[model samples]
Target: MLSPNTTLKQIEILGYLGTKFPNWIGDDSFNNIVDIKLSGSQHCSNLPPLGQLPSLKILHISSFDSVTTVGAEFYGNSSAKKKPFSSLEILIFKNCHYFEALSMSDGQCQELTYLSIYCCRSFVSFPNGGLIAPKLSDLNIYNCPELMWLPEKMTSLSSLKSLTIRSCPLIKAIPEGGLPISLSKLRINYHQLLRIKWNWQTLPNLKNTLSEEGFPTSLSSLSISGCPLLKKIYDTKDSENKEYWRKISHIPHVGGSSERQEEDSFLNMKQAMF
Candidate 1:
């Protein structure tokens, strides 16, 4: 048992084999804790109610193989008036093979600025009504092969600035109603099936747009790979590709296969002449 006078502010437990935590884990004495990370705890079927910790600002959950859903239990049902995750600013879920859905109860994530879901292959989508994070600035989803959609009405996240989706092949488009104009940087890589049919009408403020790996260079706005059809539209000179070019014409950078070819051509010309 932790001492009542304990002022511990951070806790990290990794590779724990316990099926459940001691009841004291949810005690109010942990209210001062600001960060918690539980990783590689393969036997734990459920997570401790770390949300009850009033000062918690960051949480990272990884490789919890048995946990399938994060539901009301995560918010601590001890009281109706409690506001869980009220101060959380960053949350990450990684390599949870069985994690399928995330459902919140009385939690408030308005202060959450960074959220990431990585390598959770079984994660399908958020629960209905979706996560509500009004202040989220950066969201990254990587290698979540089964993810079907982004959070509902993501346009409501007016403060969102960066969104990166990599290797989430199932996500066909952005969330309904399109992304907020506040978004400045967007990256979607290895989405072979993404149809590029999103509403580009509201993205006048988007400073940086889609690319494969790194930030598009000063001359690049969009870089695509594993998208042959888009490449065709870009390479061919015809009337049919006009709309396709128009969709991305507003972006003001350049880095992609075309740039690579230009570099190769320059090298070849130098070698042939010299």
Candidate 2:
């Protein structure tokens, strides 16, 4: 539906409209619509099968309060074998308060390049195993208090280059396996709880050494804020901690800050010690 009724909340509306609208892309219909923005509708139990639209390139959804989980219903056909949203490049979700999980299918969203999630407090998990998105290059997440863990298999996102996480208090560590070696730019702020807990062990002061364990070998840019303890482990003037500094010394840019900002993308994120 090119002109969406802002008041409509029924998931059936799109399917009904599909027959009336004939926009073709590849083997799918309703392909002419490149952008869809849905906001303030809270009654839908699941995200509509927007994934079936092969030509959709940008999707923005906000304030759909009743959608507690993102699962097979979001991906039409429920077949991992068939690529969904074959041409989508940007996907954004904001203020989805009750959103809890997202179950992505294999090869779905393969062409996506940017993804952002904002203020989804109850959101909990992403796809359990790697739902590969080879073209994804940027991912930004903010204020999702319960969504902590990054995908454990970063390698699955082979093209990921920039990552931003701000104000997510519960995420305690990077992906369990480690930051994907492919990550080039990283910005983190207000993950005070997480910065103090990246170490595999939960014990106190047992060496929360990310560089030694599995921080990426290289990054073009790095910024960290509101993580004093983490800064301590890496930024050291003490002779005993020279090794730690030496480990990350090769990075060309390093910045740190104590403040949080409304915008968390690369442009607004200033230099901070990372």
Candidate 2 global TM-score: 0.66
Q: Count the backbone clashes (under 3 Å) in each candidate.
A: 7, 5
> Distance (Å) between predicted and true CA of 222, model 2?
3.9
The model with the greatest TM-score is 1
User: Per-residue lDDT for 1-274 in model 2, tens only?
Assistant: 3544333332222212121122322224455666777677646666667777756788888888788887776666765455788888998988999988777767788899998888899988888885478898998888898876877687567677788887787877766555544565667774553354443232122123345534444445556676556545543344565565566565555555534332243222222323
Clashing pairs in 2: 255-271, 255-272, 255-273, 256-272, 256-273
Worst 10 residues of 2 by lDDT: 11-20
Model 2 has an lDDT value of 0.64
lDDT agreement with native, every candidate: 0.71, 0.64
Record all residue pairs in model 1 with backbone atoms less than 3 Å apart, i.e. clashing: 219-253, 219-254, 220-253, 220-254, 220-255, 221-253, 221-254
- The local lDDT score (0 to 100) that residue 77 gets in candidate 1 is 54
Q: Write the per-residue lDDT of candidate 1 for residues 124-161, one digit (tens) a residue.
A: 97857766888889998888899878888877778888
